[model samples]
Target: MPEPPPTADVSTALVTGGSAGLGQVIAATFADAGYRVVLVGRSSERLDAAKQQLDTQPGRDIVTLAGDVGVREDCDRIASTIEDQFGRLDVLVNCVGTSDRGLAGELTADRLHELIDQNVVTTLLCCQAFAPLLESSRGSIVNIGSLAGKVGARYLGGYNAAKHALAGLTQQLRLEWRDKGIHVALVSPGPIRRDDAGTRYRDRTDATLPASASAPGGGTKVKGLPAATVARAVLACAQKRRTDVILPGYLRLLIVLGNAFPRLGDWLLLKFTS
Candidate 1:
């Protein structure tokens, strides 16, 4: 058998929403690649399961933090835990998100607010609380955004708005923290896939999902991507400290053309995406 490559002793990570979906893949990818992982989520059982799944990897530290990023104190508490245990955080992946579907006049203001808190507030809280730790090692932050924010998805109105805000936040943080030795990056991917599909975009909040359910836009039945592919995209951006990245090829064009002429892009999107 061939020998595997060696990993660096400096590798350490804190992944929000790391119990499932893309966050799960991100955690596993880092673990398999030999980074000590701090998995954050709301459910202790789910966190334990995720830790167990990666237990086969030796020389890797796995810490499960069960808390809400949406709450300020919870974010502080999680940060303290990381400080107490690891003393320094080398990488931080923000995968906390929520989605609500309503078309035209059907979406409510409350739902809009929920989506904002999920996509914007939670990320801000996490980044703010971890700034000190990330600065200690000049680590990077990888925020998983959505391409829908680049264009528009009709029924995903609130979701698109929240993610749009996240894109802006990504840029603001990257620039403001650049001289502070903290690298910030955003990875805007299209609909991501997982082997065991679950309630991914069910509501406008990051509420507890059922044991099993369909993914957004009936994607559960569609032939879709593997979570590992998205994980690799994240890895590429982190290794290079790129400002931002878009996946699945098609989305990148949309990002370019959309920014160049947004109105024209909106017309095309409504015409075709519908």
Candidate 2:
């Protein structure tokens, strides 16, 4: 309800999984907003390409670091690199995550662990490594979450479980880190419109699942959000210090209704995806 926090003093921002997809877009968004942006990822080739793309945009300060944020040691190294070069970090966006395809009933332990590592552990490690810096700068951390985190969507394998864990973790981090002058937020968007949206899960979906299973959000009726829109929301959450944000703001009412009444929620979800 209060006006969003001012971002006038924000100087440097770091984004994990910044080489491609939503991460890259988030990095660009920050850079375009006049912040020095650092991108961390696993592949140098992809990082280089991302840097090149940002370079063509002109007037954007961008740095790319190759490292797996899911690894504690790698995160520590990344934190060190940022400290050495930038001297301070004002924002850290945890954008490293992977979506899944398959029925929850059919989900396997191995698969669930993999989902947690990719969707949750990576953010946890990054936050741990960057806490001191963020504290020093009174900075903000925005974890990119998914709509799956808010509700148990069907046919997403362990993704709903993984994102739900992330949602809980984000809240815990915000409460635990508040006294340290760090603001943590989560931006959970529905299926985002991307170049490979529908086909990315081709290999993971099968006969047991409907043809829509391979689509984004397991073919949820929600329209695909523009990646840029999601990026703007991330920036706003950091600047505004918002708590939990769901894309298509209207869905918040639906989410609340779903949470309060199980039968009605089930019917709504089924209708939306039918």
Best candidate (score: lDDT): 2
lDDT of 2 by residue, 1-274 (tens): 8944434344999999889998899999999999989998999999999999988988888888889888899999989987876788999999989889888787889999999999999999999999999999999999999889988888888999999999999999999999999999999999999889889998889777899989999989999999999999999999889989999899999999999998999998898784
Full-model lDDT for every candidate = 0.77, 0.91
RMSD of every candidate to native, in Å, equals 5.8, 5.6
Full-model lDDT, candidate 2: 0.91
**Candidate 2 stretches greater than 4 Å from native:** 1-10
Candidate 1 local lDDT, 24-92, one digit each (tens): 888888877767889999999999998887776676667799999999899999988777766778889
Query: Native-vs-model 1 lDDT?
Result: 0.77
TM-score of each: 0.84, 0.95
lDDT of 1 at 112: 88
**Residue 110 CA error for candidate 1 (Å)?**
0.7
